[model samples]
Target chain A: MPVPAHHPVDILRFNTCGSVDDGKSTLIGRLLYDSKNLMEDQIEALERSADITGGGQINLANLTDGLRAEREQGITIDVAYRYFATPKRKFIVADTPGHVQYTRNMVTGASISNLSVVLVDARQGVIEQSRRHTCIASLLRIPHLAIAVNKMDLVDWSEERFIEIRDQFEEFLPRLDMKDVKFIPLSALTGDNVVEPSSKTPWFTGPTLLGHLESVHIGSDWNLNGFRLPVQWVNRPNNPTDPRLHDFRGFSGQIAGGIVKAGQKVMVLPSGLISRVKEIWTYDGPVPEAFCPQSITLLLEDDIDVSRGDMIIGPDNLPGQSTELHAKVCWMHQRPLQRGRKYFLKHTTQTVQAVVTEIEDRINVSTFEPEPDAPELALNDIGEIRLKTAKPLIFDGYAINRLTGSFILIEQGTHATVAAGMLFPPTEAVKPEYTDFSI
Target chain B: MNSYHLDHLQYLETDAIHVMREVAAEFERPAILFSGGKDSICLLRLAEKAFRPSDIPMPLLNIETGHEFPELIGFRDRRAKELGAKLIVRTVEDVLARGLATAAPGEVSRNRLQIPALLGAIEEFRFDCCVGGARRDEEKARAKERFFSFRDSFGQWDPKNQRPEIWNLYNARLNAGENMRVFPLSNWTEVDVWEYVRKEKLEVPGIYFSHERECFRRGGQWLPIPPPHAGAGQPDPYAGARPKPAEKHAKLVVRVRTIADMISTGMIESRADSVDDIIAEIAAARVTERGTRADDKSSEAAMEDRKKAGYF
Candidate 1:
């Protein structure tokens, strides 16, 4: 086969979240329009819909507010994804709703985003909605954040006002534990500082919002500390036609963390069984080594008992294995999450019955404070809770590796996913009692 | 080698492959919803890479509208035969024959009938999951769908009540009589499809390329002029929709951007014969891919309505 002529470009997945009045949709519309991502037909559609706005200007929000109710109400109700690619990179933007009642949607969008853009209306500076979104991004451990101080024209493109808004975020951003934060002032409606730098912001020396998004170094976003592979399936071709695959039994999964190579020694969790990697097989072919996020099939030297839900890891770094888990979750269902309610906790490849042992406290999003002894976690509520699982869950803290650190709650009988959770780091690491098998 | 980075195509490929493998390992009986369109052609290629060196684990399922382009049907059969994968075709004619669905008089497109045809196949085979080639960028409502979209026993989609998909983890749990529609191409766009098709060197039907055909204009879209004696047997589903001699038909070189029933699918005039040319044309094109799809043009939420009613 001929090599693909197109050069491989890495993908960047990010999300935008803020209040309805923050002009989040307009900013996204400007980004797409100014970036030349909008097709001619789409622009025509915008013009046709422009008649409805009465201002003779296209309603940019119509691009994202797709649902009938959302468009009718002039607000985003659910998360909608938009894709656009430049020569340098491809972007997958999760345009999430800004309503305070839609915290679940934001958390769902934030789960896989490498970066997050929290828009702040320049007129309002940093408000409760800004803090709440920033708090969610921090809690989700999104590697990068861009605080787009939008509507700069309304604030006279004042450098002083921009700094004031930046200061407001700086005060709470520290408490939020954000590592990479970039603040840019822009006017979405006027198309200033979105794709190209605006002349109005001569005082601002930073790159435009699109420039930052395109140039941000996201290579180190993945947790590459220890080898973690939650085996999703066991690949056994058992093909009678080919002699090489007759007895093929390989553990298959996407490498969640770190790297693995042929002949590397590894341990299978929950079983404590040690084995050496016999081969690493990708769709292209076998390779010497593979890193995080590559889905590959591995053949082991020993035929150990490993199945779905079982995690395989390198012996160097041990993960916490326990029946009790403490996690912060954003409740999604109408039924409030209270003490002693049993639900299905799906973490990685495993799903187990878990019960809420205690609702530690609800974090008041506005104040960034943990209100202790909260009765229940109502819909859109973010709170820390304790749980006991039917089986021991093998995981790392959410701060360490998002793949191994996060889980979801599925309500029993209904099977509706009710919460998105981030697991707290293990209070104590599991002892390497099974190391004897390595010898 | 020091920098572990995947090309955009490679990332999407792996992501899709992961979802395919999940369906293989999770569902009891799974099948791919192949339509022989460009998107599904790319989907078939992804399936090849996903389970290759071994036969595809599942069968290829298609819901024929009985108004399909003959070239596409031919490609579908040949591709399935080449892959050594079983091809299951359930047609709208079968649904009509069984009196399960009725067609309106003068209805040119049997698109609505496809819902019953597809659901029947799922029931007949007891398929717990049907993998499709639907992409989010194709329509507005599609952009809000999860990778693993859940369907009730009636095959209805509830956009509001969807499972929260986190990371690469998917919730494939479903109740009895219920099935799941998993979209591996949920993140891919029309341009990506063409690009991947070029890179993979996958073969599609001839209709995707520009060709000369007799056509007429309606609703600002060029539609092929069907032969007077088309589907000459049993009842013409499009009986009253046939044009009279007074109406003008012209010969034009056109290609379909989005393939549906010939009666409903609109063709854009083009000379883009190769995938490379097609990509360049798309780059300069003014409209969305679905802008030519008459089925989606009926209402602002037509796609959403059909999807909720179990249309793929």
Candidate 2:
């Protein structure tokens, strides 16, 4: 197997949501098919299971329906992941169910996704399910939004219908904290403006779905201004035969931001001891420099002490070091997240004991407003909370670097991951101390 | 030095490496489950990268079915030697001798018998975490798996009550008699595994490629001929004695679609003899990789049911 030389270094994770009949599966199937990513055996399997739909023609939904029950029910029971790659980029699509009951699945998909594509049937045009998905996307703070106006062919490619839905979304978009939102009116079923330009929608001049994905400026998406590498392993090849590697010691991790090259001065978080990059090793071979998201083993020039769970940082651009954290979290477990509950706080490679100090407020999804003084966060509820960790963690705001700024709450007894949290700026940002202040 | 913020791929990679390191750090005795398959092979590569410079910190564990393709076993032994990692081989036959697993009088496949052997090995070694190469996209039950999947004292996976994985945060907290099944490639798909293997130029078993072999037809599939019992009642025996007059069998030329045990594995007629051909074959495939696994063909929730019972 020849690995494509140009691996898409920048990954764009996106989730799709819509009502049962909104053609979400068809759209994903079309995107994958148009991209030439489907294999022959997959097609054969689809043909084999085509009888489940009874329409005789292949049900595009089957492409994502991996479970037998799902195939029988013709519904996406759980989140099914689909992958496709183009010459320019690779996509990991999370095809989540659109039903209200499966909102947790949608959140699970959207949590890591950079973009959210909320499909709406042109005939129905922004129904309650559409609102719910958009709200979830907004709550999750997905940076990009593509309001795919599907089934345009059924509307005879009417511009009025497209504009009506676009306007409807615009009214709700202002209330959300989305940084980038684009509305594309096209049909996902007939392959209109999904992979290629559609002749029917000549009036729409924007790029097709594929074009937008390829051209989207993801370079600035990472918080490169700050460097954060949560140490995953301590590389020590204690092998005497490999003399060169015998003395070789490095804190191995993927560079989470900013340019990291050989000979650059770096520091370990909390310790603040400076060191230099000895060598950067990737699966391909050694490279002079590496950037965000590329998995590479780094050999430090100096043997400054380091271990797993320790963070390596740029000497000058350091993250906030704190033991108390304020964050917005989405509770995922059936047990509500409450104050004084002890749970495991997993941040990066480190897992430490933590307790919820307080639940500040809960956001009402329908109105996009926060309810102050919320007592507890139930499953699928997004709320602001404070936590006290057993040890100090070096981190940036979740808005800055998602990798270093997020943490999960695990139930003490069950070891269940109960909540997903994005950290806000530390409360102790400013402080002063003086011995003679009393005098 | 150029400073680039971490992207999704880097995040996923770091996360996986971190998980591997955690398994090494937390478990007093940890071993990677190596099946000589592509996913496990990629895991071997990751394990190398995780604790490299130093030898892989843990041993490579293989539960031999005594029915695997010869090429796969040979490749498994060779790769373990090449990597300089300790290989621990546990067999179903041993378990049967110890009365841990029982076999049906005429049945050939010991796939179900693997669970007890694996659990026995875990207890024998007292391994806290068993790093596997299972990916979420392989099956429905897998899709619901967490990065740190918890197994109770009985080694059962509760899919409905799985731990929440937020960001790259993984909870590896376990109590006495509990174990963790960590999948570093939980987010990776089958294509991703192949692409990574191809990209890394990683070595895999020869059976992955198309090859000519003597086979017999059963249930609309071609079963390999090594296991003489597989041809027991058939009329035509390609190599051994012919069956009774009433029985039916045909000597056919075929190639393996996906390699499994000799008795249960199925073959697809293909001229794809090279890596590129396989990639092309997979790219155009609609049926999943597990479609050829006879064990999964039993039911839609077959994989899930098995996984809940601690089948890797």
Candidate 3:
């Protein structure tokens, strides 16, 4: 219906996270600088303010630290986003701070990313914050994990040190469920192997960090199995002049998972009514098919009563519909989450009133242990909790479909998003008795 | 039929449509902040994709500072009519006349004064969400704004306490007076906007391209020379809605990169007469898109100061 540009480079949303001194901001600054994405005014601003924030040289970190206080303190207080591109792929980097108190920021920034770059100083090795960032990325289910062992030059470009840090990650990575992991040695400050190949690393034979990032196989990252479309709204353009707008009723939503064909049979959730997909309409025209993550309007064969917050799914692979939800949550508000507190629960297109029923266990990030008897979860605390909703929610486990599986909790009066929750089955954690269990 | 991948523009279009639909479904009453600028023009096209077949589900909202270019105003009214949507205008002159807002002494720019008029309009209409075309790459302060930025009852933005927007789930729940400033173009940059415009063959105002205008130089930028002779000392050229200055104006070859209020917007001497020419000029231009904005050049944190007072 309009002009169309046919460049198919997928946009990769990723984030760079590490400790305060681990050069997370510097890495982002380097990525933007090396790509020459900084406009003249921004560069001039940097040069003008160099004397104030930097110790002589132009501080690349000054580009990302937006607030005055952040510039004054020489730290990142909030999650900042930066975008750059290569011919192979367009990139969006969420530069999240690594403060222990701001784990909520990390969780939120990493939630929508396809990959995560966890930086560690070569001299300091893997610290608590390193494990914390890795664990958060794993919990967020980022498909690809890139552990950048930065400051290789500071360690005389030692392969042994890089392998040692990689070994530490190998021991800790098994506990999480990340499929693709890459270990790269570089220096975020000295520009070694970051965007260019360093001459000192003759022993190393891998692509530069930018090259690897541009070539990562992320096409299969999205789940394309079960068809799930949470109906966002109804498109009824009752335009009298245009025939297409005459009695044009369509179910509109972004496809959360799987593939949908024009004539496929589908079921409306919460109400077990079945119907066939009459047509799939895109802005371009009526396409024969559409896939996951594309926004489109659907015309059903039958005029069933479907509205916002309703679910449209395939009959073969059904999701669990329940009023009670057991979830792993990352608390964000200063007011600790407690039992009997009613909050607004938002999942995909649906929002309902839900209350905390029980606190199963608070996860200690450093030790990877569960404090099962904790009374309440404080800010930035990750815990397993039980929630009871006033209405049934159709959702898959977070392990299957991230879009349908995750939800957020909003404070009732303030409307601030207090926690991010991932849904799972409320199964008993009782270990069955096993005598002489062998592998 | 199996083309699963979308170009960057198509993906951005899909994203904007999703956000628009979400606002329409979640908020009780929503309005789109239309400035008749290129970004807002893209927003209008996105609305068409989102809820068309029917009239746009929301009204077009604009805060007039009484200092807009005549071409911009003409384009704004015509586009609104063409789309069959109600156009709501809140003027700063009316607010000043009613003594609802006061300007600092010698404050020639009415950019800050428009905030109160806009907030007044939101309150009078009881709008829950006001969608805007603000992008993150415009300035440093705007870079931190989320897609669903929350505002207090006073219509003030607390950059420190913004809600974390994860995935596409926007929290649009608001109290009676507290509204949300939704930015669907948060991820789009200036280059992306131009590419989309060229791709969609969207019609923009004549001022964006090379045009002839009578103007004077101020702060190294071309300002439309106020109609007749201003006899020294009596030069409040933008004072009131005086009859469209009608004196024979010595016109110059100038074009503006942004279609803001005429007094605050700057013009450049260029021969870029077509969309392709404009795109090529932008590709080679060294200055940032907002570098020529007189209002933003007033202070380093000018945008931040205005946004705290609910400036879209």
Q: In model 3, which residue pairs have backbone atoms overlapping below 3 Å?
A: A237-B53, A237-B54, A238-B54, B215-B225
**Fnat (0 to 1) per candidate:** 0.53, 0.49, 0.52
Q: Can you write out model 3's per-residue Cα lDDT over A316-435, one digit (the tens) per residue?
A: 456788888999998999999999999999998999999999999998877777889789999988899999999989888888889988999999988889998888842432121232
Could you list the chain B TM-scores for each candidate? 0.96, 0.88, 0.92
lDDT of each: 0.87, 0.76, 0.83
Q: What TM-score does structure 1 among the candidates reach?
A: 0.96
Interface RMSD of 2: 4.5
Ranking by lDDT: 1, 3, 2
TM-score (chain B) of candidate 2 = 0.88
Tens-digit lDDT track for model 2 on B65-110? 7777778889989999999999999998899889987977555677
Number of clashes in every candidate structure? 3, 29, 4
Interface Cα RMSD, each model = 3.7, 4.5, 4.4
Model 2: lDDT of residue A144: 88
Better of 1 and 2 by lDDT: 1
lDDT of 1 by residue, A233-311 (tens): 8877755588888878888888888888899988888888888999998767899998788888888999899998899
- For model 2 the local lDDT of residue B297 reads 72
Best by DockQ: 1
